[model samples]
Target: MAKDHYSVLGVQRTAKPDEIQRAYRKLARKYHPDVNREPDAADKFKEIGEAYNTLSDPETRARYDRFGSDYRHYASSGAGPGGNGGRWGPRAGARPGRGGYGNVEVDMGGDVDWEDLLGGWFRQQAGGPAQGTDHEAELWLTLEEAVRGGKRTVRLAQPDGATSNYVVDVPPGVLDGQRIRLAGQGGPGREGGPQGDLLLTMRIQPDSRYRLKGRDIYVDLPVTPSEAALGAKIKTQAPAGTVTITVPSSSSSGRRLRLRGQGMPNPRGLPGNLYAEIKIMVPPSLSKEERKLYEKIGSVSDFNPREER
Candidate 1:
């Protein structure tokens, strides 16, 4: 049997939100695919990511808890109460051709967000007859979701007295602010003009363990004071899971370790580095004897941080 996500992260079933996040970060750093190079590391990272995505959000988590993994099937099939599966609009009709593909349809209400629906229309009008207006929207993803791309259904209100739902594929390496185009998904063709396109931008959900800067990823890792004093290979975590990094002895807090080509990959096919910022931590609840020992050894070195200034 597959390990439970909660178990993989080493958290209790009732762990608080922050606790769950902390656990995930710690584990992610330890097993990240780039760092470990393990055969199944990528798959493990993806599994944890899916679990976190489902459990992290209140609404989505509630649905999952109520209906389990199969809840999505129920949601899409309009199997839930209230006729329309509590969706924004109507269920899709038959798919087109063969085994029923491209046959799904949605009826968006007339009072739908005009800007969302007609932004492309106005933009097209600006340039002569305008090629079909292109639609744009943001897609929020978790770290794991980005690694293992899949389909997502989003609901939109229409100009008619109805709603419309679209199934979109979230491809891998789709970074934040990146756009995915759906051909001919724009406003109706004007006077025999070709249909426009729909542009969907991506925004990954924030993770407490990982921070992205452009294509590079940064993470703060905790290290013991002793480990910093006596350089060691410290295991750390990332969105892809965990990896071990060498920490030269005599390292200090705020030191950075680099993992080449481990950061986000861009459209140009260039991958960025992964930076691990070290934060040395002391025991918060030290006993009196431990404090005395520290004081005895305090004056061993003369290091001044502000000397450079």
Candidate 2:
């Protein structure tokens, strides 16, 4: 058997409409699954919704008072509330999945009214807009996206069994772990409150070619043995674009050449620097001509690469 509407709402059988509303709001705020961690909170909130929806309507309340939940079924199904006919469900707000109060926090969007004054002054609900707990989600960005500052779309699966695609603007110089807010996109609120904002924590995806620290970026600058030893101007990829860098004469692998203001653009202050670390690469397979050239250099030059400085 369904619980009595009055008992479910913790209200007197003679409770006034406002009183019932206040009580329902209070319970909804207390038991809403978005804010409350209790296993049965969703069920409790749903029960409160059912009670409020039934008792708030004059016709339903009168019919319920005269008969019972059995009569409620008949009334909802086009029959009078006095007879037991068909079992029926409550209105939208009563069902957790049906009305959308499970995973969203809603603030009373417009101006305060009698409901607000009554809810606040009586402490039936908090003084501020009735809201649910804050929620968090992860947002992954590429190094290019983070440095360049642009927009990206992300798919989010919410707690109340809802999935959505949200577009977010990525600000220039956004750092990892930074949070972006999408207003009114979080858990549902009690009654007619506005939804809470969804917070996204930015994460820069790992790239083999680039390593980022704060605003600075590091990248590998590959050069041949001939180029490193004799010095040359070679082009390499940077956060912003490709740039030519001059290698010092007799340069070795692991040497870093700095590029100012080329790492990441700063929206408020000085931009980060880019470092191009030199890596000497050798050909995996050498032809007869290359091997003959290497043998010629080895035979002529007495340079010992392993000798300590």
Cα lDDT of all candidates, in order?
0.63, 0.71
TM-score of each candidate structure, all chains considered together: 0.51, 0.59
lDDT, residue 291, model 1: 86
Q: What are the C-alpha RMSDs, in order, of all predicted structures?
A: 19.3, 14.0
Candidate 1 local distance difference test against the native:
0.63
* Model 2 spans with C-alpha error above 4 angstroms: 1-128
In angstroms, the error of model 2 at 244 is 2.1
- Give one digit per residue, the lDDT tens place, for model 2 in 1-309: 789989988889989888987786677657756567888776776777667766875545755775687654443322333423222233223337544234343343333343333324322212234564345566788888888888888775343424578889989889899999998886675446677687888988999999998788999998998999899999877767788899998888999998888887888899999989999999999999999998999999989979986
* TM-score, cand. 1 vs. native: 0.51
In TM-score terms, candidate 2 sits at 0.59
lDDT (tens digit, per residue) of candidate 1 on 1-309: 545556766777677777866665565555555455788766666666556655554434545555565555543332344223233322232234532224343443344454445435423432324354444455678875764467988653222313457788987557878787878875555446787776677879999888888778899979988888898897876665677889989889999999987776554687777899989999988899988877776777576667995
